[model samples]
Target: MEIEIATIGGYEEVGRQMTAVRAGDDIVVFDMGLNLSKVLIHDDVRTEQMHSLDLIDMGAIPDDRVMSDLQGDVKAIVPTHGHLDHIGAISKLAHRYDAPIVAAPFTIELVKDEIQDENKFNTENDLVTMEAGETMPIGDSGELDLEFVNVTHSIIDAINPVLHTPEGAVVYGLDKRMDHTPVIGDPIDMDRFREIGREGEGVLCYIEDCTNANKKGRTPSESVARDRLKDVMYSLEDYDGGIVATTFSSHIARVKSLVEFARDIGRKPILLGRSMEKYSGAASRMDGVDFPDVEMYGRRQGIERTFQRIMNEGKGNFLPVVTGHQGEPRAMLTRMGRAETPYELDEGDKVIFSATVIPEPTNEGQRYQSENLLGMQGARIYDDVHVSGHLSREGHYQMLQALQPQNVIPAHQNMKGFSGYVELAGNQGYKLGRDLHVTTNGNVIQLVEE
Candidate 1:
C-alpha cells in the first residue's frame, strides 16, 4: 500500500482549507473551503453565482486543478466543520468529484443550505451524516477507514477526520482548540486523541492548523468567554439605554450565551441578520440541540420591521444580537452605526463587539471605520470579549506530545506564521526537510510507497 498527502489549499493562508490523503488507490479529500478575505476584498461579489474557475483565479476558492496530479479516485469529500472557510466551496466544486460529501450532522445540514443557495453550480453530491466518534469504510479497500474524532471549535459539530490505513492513521488535524469546558458541546476529545497516539501504527502524519501557533499559552476555553460575557451583560443590567451585541454569526455557543444573558439582564434577545438566522436557525432545528426560542429576522423587510418594533417597544427592553462584528458595511451593526436602519443608537448606548478584529487589511480598515462611525454617534463600544478558536504555542506542543506522529506538517498559515510551530516541533525532535514538512498549496508529500 502507498500513502500520500496533497496540500491543495489553505497551506499558505488561514482560509480556503482543502487537503487530500491518498491511501493506495483510494483517496479522501478534506475541507473544500473558500478564502473569505479574498472574497471580502472585492465589492458586491456574490460567491453563490460565481464560477469555480473564476473564484480560483480570484483566490477566493481552492484551485483544485492539482487534484489531477493525485493518481487515486476520490472516495469521500469530508468537511471537518461547517465554517465557510472549511465548507464554503463545496457548492462550487463538489460537482466535479463523484464522492459523497461526508460530515457531522450539523455540518451536513449547513452544506445542504449552501448547496440550496448556489446558483452557478448544481452540487448533487450525496450528503452523508456521520457523527463524531463514528467510522465509515472508504472506497472498496477494506484496509481504509474514515473516522471522525470530536474536536471543539467556535462552532458546534466540529471534528478532526482521521483516515485509518494499513500504513498508519493519517490525522487531518486542522482548525481546533484545546477546549475542555466548551459551552454547547463536549470538550476537545484529548483522551481519544491520546488513545489514537498509542494505538495501531500510531499517527503516521499529523497535519496541524498553525493559525495561533505564534501566541503563547493554550487557547482559553469557551467557558472562559462565556463567563466574561455573563459578567459584562450583568454589569449592564441596570442601564436604561439600548445595548446591541455582535459576534460571528456561526458561533452558536457564544450566541446562546448572549441570548441567555440578555434575558437575565431584563431584556428580550433578538437575533438580526441573514447569517444570524441561518446559523442559529440550523442549530435550533437540530436534534439534541437545546437552543432557546428567540426572535430572528433574516430578510431585509423582516429585519427592518424588527428594528422598528425594537424602537417602538423601547430599545431598553430588547438586546439585538446582530451580524457585522468586523464592521462589514451592510451588516446589521454597521447599518445601525450609519443610522440607516430603523434602530437608532442613542447617546451612551452600548455596542458589544464579542469578536476580535480579524487580522487583515480589509477587515482592520473596515472595523476601524465602523468603530469611528459608531463613536461619532455616541455609541460606547465594548470589544474583544472572546477567545480565539485556534491553539497557541503550548497547545501545539501538547498536540505533538499526544499524537507523536512520525511526520508533522504545519498548515493554515504562511511560512512566517509557522515559525512558532516549527520551533516547538524541533523541541520534540522533529526536523525540517525530514519528518517535519513545511509545504505550500498544490504540493504532494509521499510518506509511504509500495
Candidate 2:
C-alpha cells in the first residue's frame, strides 16, 4: 500500500485547517475548517450567504481544489472538535465531497446546526455519530480503520481521530492540551496514546497543533483555571456593584464555573448573547455533559427584556455572563460597551473577562477598542482570567516522548509560530525536510511511493 499526505489549508496560518491522508486507494479528510480571522477582518461580511469560491478567494475557508490532485476516494470527513476553526467550512465545502461527516456527538450537532442555518449551499453529507474510544472501518479495505481517542480542550467532547492504515497509524492531533483533570469531560488519554505508540507498526505520521509553541512551560489544566476563577468570584462576594462575566461561549466548562460561582456569591446567573445561548443550550441538552440549567436569552427582544429586568432588580442581585471576551463587534459585551444595549455600566461595575486576546492584529485592535469604550463608561475590567487550550514547549516535549512517530508535521500555526516547535523537534533528533515536514498549503508529500 502507498501512503501520501496533502498539506492543504492551515499549513501557513492557524485558522483554516484541512488535511487529507491517502493510504492506498482510500483517503480521509481531517477538519475542513475556516480561517475565522480572515472572515472577521472584513466588516459586514455574512459568510453563511457567501459562495465557496468567493470565501476561498477571500482566504476565509480552505481552498480544497488541491483535493482534485489526490487519487483516492474520500472515505470520511473528520472534524476533531466543534470550534469554528475546525468545523466552520463544513457547510461551505462539504457539498463537494461524497464522504460522510463523521465526528463526536457534540460536534455532529454543531455541524447539523451549521448546515441547517446555511443560506447558499445545500450540504447533505451523512452525519455519523461516533463516541470517543470507538472504532469504525474506513472504505472496503479491511486493513484500514478509524478511531477516536478522547482528548481534553476548552470545548467538551473533543477527540483526536486516528486513521489506522497498513503502513502505520496517522494521528490527527490538534486543539488539545495535556489536561488530566478537566472540569466536564474525561482526561486526555495519555495511556491510550502511549499504547498506540508501541502498538502495530507504530505511528507513521504525527500532525500536531503548534498554537502555543513559542510559549514556555506546560499549558495549565482547565482545573487550574477553575480554581483561579473560583477564588476570584469568592473574593467578589462582598462587593455589591454590578458584576459582568465573559468567556468563550464554546467553553462550557468555564461557563459552568461562572454560573456555579455566581450562585455561590448570592447572585442570580443569566447567560446572555447569541453564541452563549447557542453553545450552552446545545451542550446542556447533550448526554453526559455536567452543565447546569440556567436562564439564557439569545434573541434581541428577549436579551433586551432580560437586561431591563436586571437593571430594575438591581445590578448586585444578578450576574450576567455574556459573550465578547475577544471583543467581537456584534457580540453582547461589545454591544454593551458601545451602550447600544439597555444594560448600563456604572462607575464601579466589574467586567470579568475569562478569555485572553487571540494573538492576531485584528482581534487585538477590536479588543483594545472595546476595552477603551468600557473604560470610558467607568467599568472596572478584570481581564485574562483564563488559560490556553494548546500545548506549550514542555507539553510538546511530552507528546514527542509519548508518540515517538517516524514522521512529524507541525500545524495549526504560522511559520513564525512553527519556529519554536521546529527547534524543539530538532532537539529530539528529527531533521527538517526529511522526516519533520515544514510545509505550506496546497502541497503534497509522498511518504511511500507505490
Candidate 3:
C-alpha cells in the first residue's frame, strides 16, 4: 500500500485551498476552496457565476496538480467545514472526479446554497451527508477506510477526518479548535479521538490544521462573543438611531446569539444581504435552528426595505444583521457606505463588527474606507470585538498530547505556520518529512508499513 498527500492550494498562501490524500489506489480530496484574496481583490473574479474551472484554466490556482492521477480512483471529496475557503472550490472542481462528496449536514447545506447562488447546478457528483460522530464506508479499494470525527471550528459541523489503512490510520485534524464550549455543536469527541489513537496500529501520520499554529493559549468559546454582543447591543439600545451588526454570514451560532440578544432587548432581528438570507434559510431549512418569525426581506429589495424600515421604525427597534465583516465592497456594510440604503448613519448610531480582519491588503483598505465612511456619518464603530475559530499553538499542543498520534503533520498553513508546526514536531521528537511531514499543495505523501 502507498500513501501520498499534496497541498494543491492554501499551502504557500492561505486560500484557494485544495488538498489531496491518496491511499494505495484510492484518492480523496479535502477542501476545494477559493482564495478569497485572489477572487475578490487581485483577479476580481466577481459574482457567483465565476466558474472554478475558468479560474483553473486561467492559472488562478493550481488545478491540474490537484486533479491529476485520480480520474477514476477518486473515492470521496470531503470538506472539514462550511467555510468558503474550505468548500467553495468543491462543486467546481470535485464534480469532475465523479465521486461522492461527504460533509456534515450544515456544510452540505451551505455548499448547496453557494452552488445555487452561482446559478450552477452540480448534480453530477453524489452528495453524502454525515453527522459528526458517524463513519461511512468509502471506495472500492481494499485498503482504504474513512471516517469523519466532529470537532469545533469557527463555523459549525467541523470534522477531523480519519483514513484507516492497512499500514495504519491517518488522521486529518484539519482546521479545528478544541472549543469545549462551542456555541452550536456538541463538544469535542475526545473519547473517540483517544480511542482511535490508541487502537490504530501504525497511525502513520496525523495532519492537523495550523491556521493558528503560532499563537498561544486556547481559543475562547463562541459564548464569549455572545456575551460581548449582548452588552454592545444593550449599550446601543440607549441610542435612537439605526444600529447595525455585521459578521461572517456562515457564523450561524453568532447569528443565533444576535437573535437572542435582540429578543432580550426588545428588538426584532432583521437579516440583511443575500448571504445572510441564504445561510439563515439553510440553517432553518436543514438544521432546525429557526430565527423568531422575524421579518426577512430577501436580497436587493430586502436590504432596501430594511433601510427604509430603520428610517421609519427607528433602528433601536430592530437589530440589522448583515454581511461584510471583512469590508468586502459589495457586502451590506460597503453598500451602506455607498449610500444605497435609505437609512443613513447618524450621531450615536452604532455599527458593530463582530469579526476580525482577515489580514489581506484589499481587506484592510476596504475596511479602512468603510470605517471612514461610517465614521463620517457620525456612527460609533466597533472593531475586532470577536474571537477566532482556529485553535492556537497551545491548543494544538494539547490536542496532540491528548490524541498522542504516532506521527504528526501540519496542514492549512502557509510556510511560516508550517515552520511552527515543524518546531513543535521536533520538540515531540518526530522527524520532519518522515514521521512529521510538512506537505505542500498538490504534493502527496504516502504512509508505508514500517
Candidate 4:
C-alpha cells in the first residue's frame, strides 16, 4: 500500500488551508481556501484584472502547482465549513480539476454565492452536497470512501472528513473544538471518533487543527459566549443611546443569541451588511437557527435606509448587529464609525466588538483605525467579548486520547502554533519526526504498512 500526504498551504501560515491526500492511484483534496490578510490588501480593480496564477503568486490563494502532474487523478475537492479561510478560494481553484466539489449544504450555498458574485471561473463543475455522518464513494471505481464526521465550531455544519483507503483510514481534523454545550448544533461526535479508532485497522494518520494548541485549556463553548454577551448587553438596558454589536458573520449561534437578547430587552433587532444577510439566510435555510422576527439589510442602500429609520424611531429602541468585528474597511461597523451611515454615534453610544482580532499585523492596524474613528465620535467601546473556535491544549489532549491514531500530524497552523501539539504529543509518547510529524508547507509525508 502506498499513501502520501502533501501540505500545500496552511502549514506555514494560518490561512489558505489546502491539503492533498494521495492513496494509491486516486487523489483527494481538502479545503481550497484563501489567505484573507493577503487578499484584503489587494486593490479591487487590480484583483479583478489579475489571473488565478497571478493571485496565487501574490499569496491570495493556495499554491497548488505541485498537483499539476496529478490533476487527472484528483477525485474531489472537499471543504469543511463556510469560513472564508476554508472555502473562499473554491471559485478560483475548483475549475482547474475534473473533480466535483463536496461539502455540507451551508458551505455549498456559501460557495455558490461566492461563484455568483465573483464569476472568477466560467467552467461547469459539479457540486455535491453531503450532510454530516454521511459517507460517499469517490473515484470512478469507488476505491475510496469519504465520511463527514460532525463537529462543533464557530460555523454551522462544520465537519472532519475521514478517508478510508486500502491501507487504512486517514482523518483530516481542522477548525473544530469539542463543545458539549454548543448553542446551535449537536455536540461533537466523540463516540464516532472512538469507533473509528477501535475499528478496521484503526486510524493510520490523524492530521489535526493546531490553531489554538498553545492555549492551556479547552476552548469555551458558543454558549459561554452567549452568556458573556448577555452580561454585557443586560447591563445597558437603561442607556439612552444606540447599542451596536459586531462579530463574525458566519457565527450563527452568536447571532441567534444576540437577536434573542435584543428582543428580550425590548429592542428591535436588525442585521446589517451583505455578509450578515448571506450567512443568516443560509443558516435559516439549513434549519440550523431560527430568527423569525429579526430584520435584515443586505445592501449599502438598504443599510442606510434602515439606519435612517432607526434614527427616526429613536436609536435606543434598536439593536444593530453588523459586520466588521475585524475592522474591515467596507464592513458596516467601519462605515458607521466613519460617519457614512445615517444614524450618528452619540457621545455615550455603545460599540461592542463581539469578536477577537486575529492577531495579524493587518488586522491590528485596521482595528486601530476603526477604534480611533469610533473614539473620535465619543462612542464607548467594548472589545473582545468572544470565544475562540479552535482546539486548545487540553482539547488536543482529549482528541489524542480518543482517536489514538498510530501516526499524528499537526496541521492548520505555523511552527509557533504547532509547538503546543508537539509538547502534547510528546507527553503521549509520540516522538518528534517519527510517529509524530511536524511538517511545513510543500512537504510530503508517506505512510506505508510495516
Candidate 5:
C-alpha cells in the first residue's frame, strides 16, 4: 500500500486551497478554492461578486494539479467548511474531475447559492452533505477512508478531515481554532479526535493549520467577541439613530451574538447584501443551528427601501447588519459612503465592525479609505472588536501536546511561518526534514513503519 499527500494551493501562499491524498489508484481532494485576497485585489472586483467563474480561464484559479492526479480515479472532493477559501473554487473547477463534492450541510447551502447565482455548473456528480462527527468511505477502492470531525472556527460546523490510510491515519487539521467554548456549536470533539487518533494506530502524520502559528496563546472564544460587541452597543443607548454591524457572514457564531445583542437593545435585526442572506439562510436551514428570524434585503434599491422604512419608523427600532466590514469598495458600506443609496448616516449613527483587518495590503487600503469616509460623515466607527479563527503558536504547541502524533508536518503557511512550527516541533523532540517535515505545495511526504 502506498499513500501520498500534496498541497495544491495554500502552501507558500494564503488562499486557493486544494490538497490531494492519493492511495494506490484512489484519491481524495480537499478544498478546491480560490486565492480570494489576490483575486479581489488584482481584478478590482468586490470580494463577494468575484464569483464569475470566467476568472479561472484568466489563470486566476490556483494550481489544479492536485485534482489532476486522480483525473479518473477521484472518488471524493471535500471541503471541510463553508469558508470561500475552501469551497469557492469547486464550482469553477469541479467539472474537470468526476468525483462528488462532499461537505457539511451549511457548506452545501453556500455552494448551492454560488451555483444558482452563476447559472453554471451542469453536472450529475453527487454533491454530498455529511454531518459532523461521522465517518464515511471515500471510495470502493478500500484503501482510503475519510471522516469529518467537528471543530470550531469563526464558522459553525467547521471540520477537520481525517484520512485513514493503509500506512496509518493522517489528520488534516485545516483552518481550526481549539476553542473549547464555541458559542454556536459543540466544542472541539476531543473525544472523537482522540478516538480517531487511537484507531489510526497513533496517527502517522498530522498536517495542521499554521495560519496563526506565530501568535501566542489560545485563541479567544466567540463569547469574547460577543462581550466586546455588547460593551460597544451598551455605550450607545443614549443616542438613537442607525446601528450597523458587519462581520464575516460565515461567522455564524458572531452573527448569532450580534443578533442577540440587537434584540437586547430592543432593535429588530435587518440583514442586507447577498452574503448576509446566503449564510443566515444556510445556518437557519441546517439541523442544529437557528438564526433569529429577521428582515433580509438586498440590492441598493431594496436596502434603500428598508432604510427609509427604518428611518420613518425610528432608527432605534432596527439594527442594520450589512456587508463591507472589510471596507470593500462595492460593498454596502462603501455604497452608503458614496450616497448611492437613499439612506443617510446621521451624526449619532453607529457602524460597528466585528472583524479584524485580514492584513492584505489592498484590504487595508480599502478599509482605510472607507473608515476615513465614514468618519468624515460623522458616523461613529468601531473596528476589530472580535477574535481570530486560527490558532496561534502557543495554541499549536498545545495541540501537539494533546495529539502527540509521531510525525508532524507544518502546512498552510509560508517559509517563515513554517520555520516557527519547526522550532516548536524541534523543542518537542521532532527533527526538521525528518520526524518533523516542513513541506512546500506539491511536495509529497510518505509515512512508513517506524
Candidate 6:
C-alpha cells in the first residue's frame, strides 16, 4: 500500500490550514481554511470581487494548485471545527472538487451560513453531517474509513478525526486540548484514542497541533476560565456601572458561562454583532447549547437601538456581551470604545476582555488602539481572563503517550512553535526529520512500508 501526505497550507504559518492525504488512488482533504492576516491585508478593498484564485494569490486561502494533478482523485472534504480559519474557505473552494463536504452538525451549519452569506451555494456541493463518535466510509470503493473522536476545545462539537487506511490509521490531532471538565460539551475521548493506538493496524502517522508547544504543562480547562470569570463578575457586584465583556463569538461554552453569570447577577445579557448572532444561532440549531434568555442583536440598526435602550435603562442594569476580543476595527466593542454607540462609558465602568491577544502584529496594534480609546473614557479594562484551546507541552506529551504513533508531524504553527514541538518530541526519543517530520507547506512525505 502506498500512502502520501501533503501540507497544502498552515505549515510555516498559523492560518489557512489544509492537508491532503492520499491513500492509493483516493485522496481525502482535511480543512480548507483562511489566513485572517492575509485576508485583512489584501482583501480589504475588493473583497466582493476576490475569487478563489485571487485569495490563493494573496495567501488569504489555501493554494489548492498543489493538488491539481490529483483533483479528480479527491473523495471528501472534512472540517474538524467551525472556526473561520478551519471552515471559511470551503464556500469558495469546495466547488473545485467533485466531492461532498463532511463535518459535525455545528460546523456544517456554519459552512452553510457562510455559503448563504457569500451567495455561493451550489447544488453540486452536498453537505453531509456526522456527529461525534460516529464512523463513516468514504471514497467510491469505501477503502477509507473516517472516525470522529470527540474532543473538547474552545468550540463545541470539535473532533479529532482518525483515517483508517489500508496501510494504517492516520490521526489528525489539531486545534484541541484535553479538557476533562469542559463547561458545556463532553470531555476528550481518551479510551477511543488509546484503542486506536493499541488495536487494529495501529497509528502510522500523527499530525498534531503545535500552536502552544512553547508553553509547559497542560493547558487549563474551560472550567478554570469559568471560575476566573465568576470571580471577576462577582467582585463587581457592588459596582454601579455597566459591565461589558468580550470574547471569541464562536466560543459557545464561554458565552454560556457569561450569560449564566449575567443572569445570576440580575443583569440582562445582550449579545451584539453579526458574528455573535451567527455562531450562537448555529450552536442552538445543532442542539449544542442555547441561550434563550439572552437577547441578541445582529444588524447595525438593531444593535444601535439595543445600546440606546441599555443606556436609558442605566448601564448597571444590563451586561453587554460583544465581539472585538481581538480588537477587529469594525467589531462592536471597538465601536463602543470609540464612543460611536449611543451608550457612553462612565467612570469606573468595567470593560472585560475574556480573551488573550493572539500575538499577531495586526491584532496587537488594533488591541492597543481599542484599549486606548476605552481608557480615555475612564473605563477600567481587565484582560486575559481566559485559557487557550490548544495543547501545551505537557498536553502534547500526554497525547503522544496515548497515541504512540510511529511517526509524528508537528502542524498548525510557525517555526518558533514547531521548534518547541521538536524539542518536546525529542525528549520522548523521536528525532527530527526521521520518526518526526517538521516540514513546510507544499512538501510531500511518502510513507514507506516498515
- Candidate 6 lDDT, 1-450, residue by residue in tens: 678888888897888899988887778899989888765543253433457877888887888888965433888899999998888788788888888988998998998887876653353578999988999997766678999999988999899888898777999987899899999889999999999988877899999989899998889999999999999998888877889999999999999999988887878899999999999988887788978867888999999999999888899899999999987878899988999889799888999999988766777888999999999988999999999999999989888898888999999988887988999899999998789999988888887533
The lDDT of each candidate is: 0.92, 0.91, 0.75, 0.87, 0.76, 0.87
- CA lDDT of 21 in candidate 4? 89
TM-score of each: 0.98, 0.98, 0.93, 0.96, 0.92, 0.97
In model 1, state the lDDT of residue 294. Answer: 89
TM-score of candidate 6 versus the correct structure, residues matched by position: 0.97
Better of 3 and 5 by lDDT: 5
- Whole-model alpha-carbon lDDT for candidate 4: 0.87
User: Model 1: number of clashes?
Assistant: 0
Per-residue lDDT tens digits of candidate 1, residues 55-124? 9999988988888998989989999999999999999999999999999999998999999999998898
Writing each residue's lDDT as its tens digit, candidate 3 over 1-450 gives: 666666577766666666777776678877778767666664445536666667776444447454565433778888888887887777566667778888888888887776656555354677789887777676786667778887877777789888888777778777777777777878878778878767857466777778777776778888787788878877765565677888888888888888888777788888888778877788888754777696665678767876886888776788888888887877888878667678777786788899988755667888888898888878888887788888887877777776677777676667787777778767877887567777666665555522
Off by over 4 Å in 6: 42-49, 69-72, 120-123
Local lDDT at 436 for model 6: 96
Superposed model 4: Cα runs more than 4 Å off: 43-50, 69-72, 140-142
Candidate 6 clashes between residue pairs 3 or more apart in a chain or in different chains:
none
Model 2, residue 247: what's the lDDT?
98
Question: Taking the tens digit of each residue's C-alpha lDDT, what string does model 4 give over 371-447?
Answer: 99998988999988999989889988888888888899898888888888899999999998789999887777878
TM-score of 5: 0.92
Candidate 3, which segments miss by more than 4 Å at Cα?
42-44, 51-53, 57-62, 69-72, 119-123
Q: Which residue pairs in model 1 clash with each other?
A: none
Query: Which scores greater on lDDT, model 3 or model 6?
Result: 6
Task: Quote the positional error of residue 33 for candidate 5 in Å.
Answer: 1.2
